[model samples]
Target chain A: MELREMSRLLYQIKLADQRVATSFERETGFSLTRYEMLMIVNDKGVCSQSEIQQEMKIDNAAITRHLKILEEKGHVQRERNVANNREVFVRLTETAARELQHCEQNHDQTNHLIAKVLSESEMQQLSALLQKLNTI
Target chain B: MELREMSRLLYQIKLADQRVATSFERETGFSLTRYEMLMIVNDKGVCSQSEIQQEMKIDNAAITRHLKILEEKGHVQRERNVANNREVFVRLTETAARELQHCEQNHDQTNHLIAKVLSESEMQQLSALLQKLNTI
Candidate 1:
């Protein structure tokens, strides 16, 4: 592919991804990163801050900031690990789990709205191409 | 498409876009957003801050922050408009334009590395699908 065409395609992919994320946030009141962090906590029942950082591929400061906001919003609770003073464990609050169910529905709706533009076959092709590109 | 499948595809697209952006930054010493902002300033010779924000679809605070960093780095110059105190004009410095030439080469190499994974037809198809998805 020509360099210009490749650059344009990359920008389009970024823009489309942002579109979905913005729509998801508008409908669910959670940024995509925050929602994914919540999912990690909900999935593990409880996990350490480092584990969340590893799972999300984010740095320490970013994870700490997101968790702080989640804690302030009463969506998560964090406590020091008993055996490890340096370790911090995080878990979703009851309010968070309940709200997550509603957010999941909104996430699905947002995905549907974006994905509906292409046919099933086109989506399959796009997914396959994306998977190939993501191999890096 | 199943919601799960759609979600996975969206995630893949996000991941791939990030991969390209991270690689470009690592190779060029400029974040993709910052590079784009510089490109806008270079293309316009001199334009208002609001024009950059509008062209980028970013908010005022973000554009201001990026421009501040660019100014500190000697990559761009920002001056208050003489006729309108509220408006600010931005232009790339000679150093920025020179460095941008090198950065552009690195950017092409980065894009080439990522795009080499897909065949030409696959890229075209992916580009078309992304255009459709971005219609919203």
Candidate 2:
């Protein structure tokens, strides 16, 4: 195992991710993490905090901070169920959905960049390898 | 060209990078970027600043910041040669070499992780693909 090679490759991948994330934030006035949160909420509808934490694999405090930021940014809203009381659900605003369609352009460009960097076969192989590694 | 799949693979790569980089920093007490500068200087002794920037493909300002940090950390020293006093030559210190040796464990682990993630053939394919994409 050439650890240095792995480190260098890992660094490259991150640099690319950062480029895309920064673009998304700049274009939409929302952080990449915040955008990801909006995505899950939009897909699953109003859900409790635990679901976000589990799905994103982010720390509890990190999720709370991100949620707070998104709420403040007006992309998401939290409503406390009056009867259930303990259940807090997050909802994406209309603006969030509209922005998502806009943000896809940036995301698509970044993905194309990656695809251009790796062949179609390599992409599948990389994805498969990563899946195996993550599972183990 | 599936952005979602590409993002997943890229995310995994970034996660692995962060984990290894954080460990490297904790063990060596130097930032990953700083360590890379030291390594680059050692490989090509007393090279020009612009040369390092070209090789790293990083923004000049980022390189400048990392160089300053490395010089202050006693891992690197910069000097101006005659001819063009504006051009600087970078040299690595003995302490830097020793520390890099100590911190190399993380690098080795990263390599192991890569090998675990991909076979030798897959590695070659990925390297070739990434290099080609990088040029584009």
Candidate 3:
């Protein structure tokens, strides 16, 4: 593709992504990153901070900062591993699990609202195209 | 589309956008938002901060924060209008103009690298799909 066309494509991707993310945050009251972090913790039952960092592809400092806020909000608890004092493990609180269930419902609605624009075939084509583009 | 498929598509779009943005920043030493802000300043010659906030669709505090960083880095200047002290006008500096030109070149290279994976038809298809999706 030519430079201008390529730039326009990238711009469109950004705008669409932003629209979806904004709707998600508005509907669910959680940023997608934080929601994903909670999902990771919930999925693993209990996982190391490093594991969450790796899964999320975020740096240690960012992970720590996010965990701190989650902890403060009573959504998660962090504890040092007794077997490995330097390692911190995180898990969701009962409150978080309950709240996450509600968020999941809202997440579905937000996703539906955004994704309803394209037909099923167009959705598949977009998905396939994004898969190819992301391989870069 | 099913909720699962819709969620997956949103996730893919987010991932692809992040990949492109990360590469752009790494290659050009400028975030896409900051680059776009500079482009706006260059395009307008001199414009009010509110005008920029409107054009960019960002909150006033965010525009102020970004402009502060840009001003500190010698890329932009903000001055209060004498006739209307509440209004702040912004324009690019000579240094910023020169640097922005170089950044534009790097941006083209970055776009080329990411976009070269898709064929011309795929590129066109993806752009049209994203345009439709963004209408949400």
Candidate 4:
């Protein structure tokens, strides 16, 4: 409620973000953006760019740029849709799949550090609260 | 927790970050990092780079670079310590004070969006959880 409390909240959010970015990079030698995009592609099996944009609530242009980078990194493959020339389909590459597996192995360690102080119930409460906060 | 839940959590965190960044830039024409550093300097009265680094959990070099930009932007002023030349003290300029005041006013609207679904208790719980998480 107070400005000081709000400042602390914002600072913690920043710290958590840095921690995640650093951890992901240190463990997998890839940026968080690359990891996230690969995970999304892996989850969807194969998805169009528009689907990724919609699901991520990101702009189409940003998605396009990131996909291009991911493609160059060999983390994902983007193919022109034959039926719809404008559409591009994306899926994870074999190398990306291996990196994602490594990511999962490292994720547990990071998650444990994040939730070290909170009990199971507290973490559940926190997660539920965050989910509520996340709803637009 | 499942990978799906973890992915969703990370996604929401990213969305929250994007929302804050967009809102701050739109409302104040300043980036989040700039705003945060300004706010920190304002809070500290006269803070050293080491102090800022400690408080924000950021590296000293990054703090120095941001402070240089903030100095150029006229949001803060830095002076070498009279007794210890290596130490630099930073404080907000009058312009920054005005901007911070504007930030507080705009902050409510952004905060409302972020916590729209959270009850007061939930917000408190979330804050407490985050505080604990920040210790690491």
Query: What is the per-candidate TM-score for chain B?
Result: 0.86, 0.73, 0.86, 0.78
The lDDT per prediction is 0.78, 0.67, 0.78, 0.70
Query: What is the DockQ ranking, best to worst?
Result: 1, 3, 4, 2
Worst 10 residues of 3 chain B by lDDT: B1-10
Kindly state the number of residue pairs that clash in model 1: 0
Measured against the true two-chain complex, the DockQ scores of the candidates, in the order shown, are: 0.43, 0.30, 0.43, 0.40
User: Which residue pairs in candidate 2 have backbone atoms (N, alpha carbon, C) closer than 3 angstroms, thus clashing?
Assistant: A3-B107, A3-B111
lDDT of 2 by residue, B42-106 (tens): 88978989999987777899898888877887878889978799999889889887767776654
The collision pairs in model 3 are none
Inter-residue clash pairs, candidate 1:
none
Q: Lowest lDDT 10-mer window, candidate 4 chain A?
A: A2-11
The TM-scores, chain A only, for the candidates as listed are 0.84, 0.73, 0.85, 0.76
Q: What's the CA error at residue B103 for candidate 4, in Å?
A: 5.1
Report the C-alpha displacement of residue B110, candidate 2, in angstroms.
Answer: 10
Lowest lDDT block of 10, candidate 1 chain A? A1-10
> If you assessed candidate 4 against the hidden native complex, which CAPRI class would it receive?
acceptable
- Where does model 1 exceed 4 Å of error? A1-8, A77-89, A105-112, A116-126, B1-14, B77-90, B105-112
- Among all windows of ten consecutive residues in candidate 4 chain B, which has the lowest summed lDDT? B1-10
In model 2 chain B, the worst 10-residue window by lDDT is B127-136
For residues B1-136, write the lDDT of model 4, one tens digit per residue: 5444544554555565566556546655676666777777887799889988887777888998999988998888889999999999899999889877876776674355444566566667777877775665
Expressed as tens digits, the lDDT of each residue in A72-106 for candidate 3 is 99999999999999999899999999898775655
